[model samples]
Target: MLIVAIILSLIFGSLGFIVTINNAKYLLSGYNTMSEADRAKMDIAGYLRFFKRFHIFLSVTLLAGVLLLYLFNHNWASSYMVLYPLLAYAYLLAKGNTFYRGTSGQKSGTYIGIAILLVVIIAVGSGMFTSLKNSEIVVTESQLEIRGAYGIKIPKADLTNVSVVKQLPAISIKTNGFAAGDYAKGSFRTTEGRKVKLFVNKEAPPFLLLNTREDEIYYSSDEVSSNDLYKKIKKWQKE
Candidate 1:
């Protein structure tokens, strides 16, 4: 997650240079689409300067905020990554109205854009908050159920093996799932090119490894003892 944050910061920082006066007509979004008459009324140079400053500030502040959050709680850092930029962009759009002198249609588009951003922020923030909660584990006579985001139920018959391990294979990337801070849940590709399901905290040790006919599962939680869970599953397997 930190790595991802760093990459994003660098990318945002670079945007200041990517869109310059020479390429504003081709690369700038709203300005590029405007008719010459409309464009003539706007302050393109001032807007560009504002754009550069916004991105640079966002880049530096995002990195600094993430670093601070990382020291306290990784989950918060992850949330910050998503929240900061979105809120910042929304602020940018609101402040940008002063630099734009387009028609009512264009002004309406900016308002619509801000509204959409707010909706997205709320949706994503809520989802992340839910996912950060500890996943529930329910063992029934017929199956082991994992309840929460990216959860699954493994039938007892298909469960081939269950054991505790200290380390996980190198994860290549998330194919389909949620990963934030030390929390990772869902499908991920291993360095060996194998797909696996994970519901574990990377910073936590001693994960329960469950092998089924269709998938390999790695499970852990900051709220649960993995060794105890492993023992329980082993006893359940024998029955």
Candidate 2:
């Protein structure tokens, strides 16, 4: 449900951005191929007026979707909500490239290159702002359940070890995942060649570490009592 809300929010938010004068060209066929002088002489007053109202409507709808996500405690999806606009912008650029090629007789290769560059920027930006918010760990006798960006369910039968630590060991590389600022939410490889999945906010401490036969995972939660969590998991491990 939250995923759907996020998709809707992104769709609406991106449309609002594309309708703006400065950014509209990305979606306007032939706009990219137009020389600055030609662009300057173009009349977009009608489009401006129409998009202005449309932007408002979409913005309002996006806010409502975000509100619902928040009210329902679907916070993991909401944590990265700000990225929706950029995702939308990327969509527009790709779409615009298609339209521009069809109408402007521009070669596809050139526009494809530009589109790739724009996509790289959005992907990097999204990674930098990646954070671990509204995440939780549920420890049971049979398995450990994670609810967040790197969510999963780990059976006790696969667990080789479990511990709570104040800080993570040095990570050599992120094998596949997201990292931004002090938050590292994704899969990473350690200097010791351990494959670890992390969902962390650097500001928070006392992380839970789980070692299955095949992988290691580190996760934390600000909303839950870390000491109590440690005790519960410890009990489960002994069982």
**Which candidate comes out best when scored by lDDT?**
1
Which candidate comes out best when scored by TM-score? Answer: 1
Segments of candidate 1 deviating more than 4 angstroms: none
Cα-based TM-score, every candidate: 0.94, 0.49
Over 4 Å off, model 2:
1-131, 191-193
Clashing pairs in 2: none
Q: Please state every model's RMSD to the true fold in angstroms.
A: 1.5, 10.2
Compose the digit string of candidate 2's lDDT tens values, residues 1-239.
34555576566656655665766567655555677765655455554555455545655656675666566544433543555445545544444443232324343654675578677767655544434354678777788887766678889888788778888978999887766434677789888887789887655788878788877788766777566777888788888
